[model samples]
Target: MSTNPGRVKKDEGFLGKLGGTLARKKRSKEVSDLHEEGKNAINAPLLPSSAELLPEDLLLEENAERSMLDPTSREDPKFKDLQKVLIDWINNELEEDRIIVKDLEEDLYDGQVLQKLFEKLSGRKLNVAEVTQSEIGQKQKLQTVLEAVNELLRPQGWTIEWGVDSIHSKNLVAIVYLLVALAMHYMAPIRLPEHVSVHVVVVKKKEGILQTAQVTKELTTTTEMMMGRFERDAFDTLLDHAPDKLNVVKTSLITFVNKHLNKLNLEVTELESQFADGVYLVLLMGLLEDYFVPLYNFYLTPESFEQKVHNVAFAFELMQDGGLKKPKARPEDVVNLNLKSTLRVLYNLFTNYKSAD
Candidate 1:
């Protein structure tokens, strides 16, 4: 391409740039001057004839209009109001939160009261009741203990018809149910006819490496009742001639469980708890039955301690009667079973008058 030297130089563009630069410089200078004047006004004291410190436009106004003072010199009522309102709001909010927190703490303490009783006992021990057919060549021998259990349960609407091969299994299942009943009440240990743990504790001298018949249970708490124990003598009393008493002892356990469970349903209607409170209650009951029920009647004397636990189920039945009398209906037939409070409160508020020292 041929170079064109005839094109007019762009003097207009250069002039426009120059003009824009000059305009910016003039504005900067004006701003600097105004800043210097404001600095002088602040640094210098007011003169006797000078108007009050105000914008220049205010000084030229009529005398009455001269009340327009420096905006900074006057207090802002709106700002003060906003500050007061904010402080008052904050204080009210803090007070409300404090009340809510106090209420929560009180409720928490109330819920855990009954669980404390688990720790009140001196302690708990293992109670095993086994009947082996091989021990005394009694393979075909009838289980009077099992019969007694069935006899006791029949009146309570539980069926007891086991096959020849299923006899032992049926017996075990029955024992489990009994244990479940025991734990349900263990949550609230009752006052026996005499002052003793309704449960029993079987003791045997250490044969080889075994030292203690004491049994261990899992706990979700660190309360005093967690480690508390019951005396051995109190526990063994249940095994005293249980079979003889089995006929008269009506199993009042099932009715009591049904009543309390129904109450729980009513109380918890539409109410939600952050903790799985209902689940905890059921689990506690299961643990009581599985871990604590059998041992509630642990009984092993120096003589029968070496031999296997015999008449295990019979012993349970015998407990109802004082060995004192033959199986008969109690004078009072209407058994009362009502839980005073929910499981959570029961556990927290759990306190035994006898255990209190």
Candidate 2:
């Protein structure tokens, strides 16, 4: 059909504009969708795969677990002070070996420092290697050192609470427990800070549910508390609360003294009064050692208080010379007829020579 050219051109233009409008709208919708998708992606959490977890991520997890389980957190001021004290003590002991422990976990994880410390404190050499580079070697050495430590602690009535794995894993709680036990057993001169405690959240899972509990634990050992009890004077307590027990202990001591003193024709009838003069103490020591204490060294009669003090002090010196630990009793305390002091000295001697013929 014959048509006007201008009209056909207008019609074509109108169709072209309509097509362009539709295409623009579709493109704008696609762009908006893509932008929304990008916003969602940015807002969503990115969870890495198990294989994608890095060493640092594992370390962070380990630290978090350790913090949760440890009695004292690393951030605690008391823990820091304790760490510094323990480090200083180890350094002082290992000074001759030229080993310095700056970080307890890092330095001790390898077991080299622990080996040296054990040797120094125990005065016995371990069969482990001086240094180990491999993980297996380090673990083996740790096992050996810890075995020796356990053996040493056996006689002290202490049960080991740490393992080679725990120690090798850089478990601070286990490490501190071991060190404190060693310090207490070897009688380390430093005083461990006491009553350090913390509340820890214990997490458990059961029946597809997570459970948590708060527990309080003391970081320091009860050895110091036990020592405080001993320092309160058990004999004094016995005398006040249980005189019959006191009489029994005194009778046992008297029998022990007379058994050793029978060679010198000395018998202790009154446990408290006889030892006050210090004559029996010196003679008892001489008899126990199978040596005659020269009469010139101690007063036989002890006419004055000064002479009594001298005699008792000389007897304590003899006790030390005989390989007995120094008693906590003072010479003046013994001379003043302090039953506690007298009993303490006699008890020490009795404990040592009870089996002697």
Candidate 3:
């Protein structure tokens, strides 16, 4: 009752302190609730939104796909050799003319020589026969044609084999082997020639909406029958025998085609079958075209064509029958003697000749 100013001041100070504590606690609770809400929002699932992938992520995906599709990983020695040979050949060309090496992409893309070399190099391996089932069906169609050709040539001291090299699941490259004995003596078979190769590369295009059958741009259409250096007599023998060889192959092909027209079946009845025919014709013609023209330039005179044709006809007739029932006539009597005409005649004969039992 005596006016305690200190006590009042103390009580006032306590009340202020209590109020400050309660207000501070309330502010702390609000802050804590806000922080918890923020945490919840961050942990919540994001709504549907478009976001661009990082460059590294895109690159990683591409690399993974490339690793799956790359053919260089195939563990075949022949494949490795093919790559090596191509590199070597490129080097050689570069040394000879810098201009040739400059357009390596074009060379790889369009060059028949390099394409053929690549094909032959791939052909050296038989593992290509083991392609996946999807490809096997198409491959078998070509295989039948090859078998027919093989049957025709096998009896004539020629060996034929084939292989398949697939490129990135987009193309199938086929190689048909025509192996002939490089006989030093006419009776004895030594080794095979380094360059007596005829490969038919039928490229089945797998890209895009419409798939087609054609020679892939990577395949070489150029024919190569490089008869390396030979002894004078051996050279002459080959030159003289060349016409007979042509006739033999021609007649055999005619017979094979005529006899096996029905035997060769395909799953699809489209031009895919014709693609096989086209490949066959290309390989066959390619083999003869190079040989036919080069023979004249290398060792034949202008006068030789007529005799060559006549001899070929007679030999062919005799080969058909043990006796030469038909008389040997002049080449003029048989047909025209130009390269173009001769090749045409040979092709026509194959397409037109009647098969004998």
On lDDT, the leading prediction is 2
Q: Please state the error at residue 178 of candidate 3 in Å.
A: 4.5
Error of 2 at 88 (Å): 1.4
Better of 1 and 3 by lDDT: 3
Candidate 1: tens digits of C-alpha lDDT, residues 175-215: 22332222222332221111111111112222221111222
Question: Model 1, which residues run further than 4 Å from truth?
Answer: 1-142, 161-164, 169-340, 343-357
Relative to the true structure, how large is the alpha-carbon lDDT of every model? 0.29, 0.77, 0.34
Clashing pairs in 2: none
| lDDT string, candidate 2, 142-255, tens digits | 999999999888777876768887798886767877887787666564556766665554444344333345556576744334222236667757866998888789889999
Candidate 3 Cα errors over 4 Å, as ranges? 1-134, 164-357
TM-score of every prediction relative to native? 0.17, 0.49, 0.18
| Comparison by TM-score, 1 against 3, better one | 3
Residues 1-357, model 3: lDDT tens digits: 498999999999999999999999999999999999997676333211222223432344221311111232223354334334334544443343332433322333222323233233333322223223454544553344344444544685553333222221222122212212111112111112232212222212122111112221221111112222223432245345675565554455455443433333412122212212122222233233222222332222223443434444533343234332332222232332222223333444354333432
Query: What are the root-mean-square deviations of the candidates from the true structure over C-alphas?
Result: 35.2, 14.7, 23.8
| lDDT at position 301, candidate 1 | 25
On the 0 to 100 scale, the lDDT of residue 221 in model 2 is 48
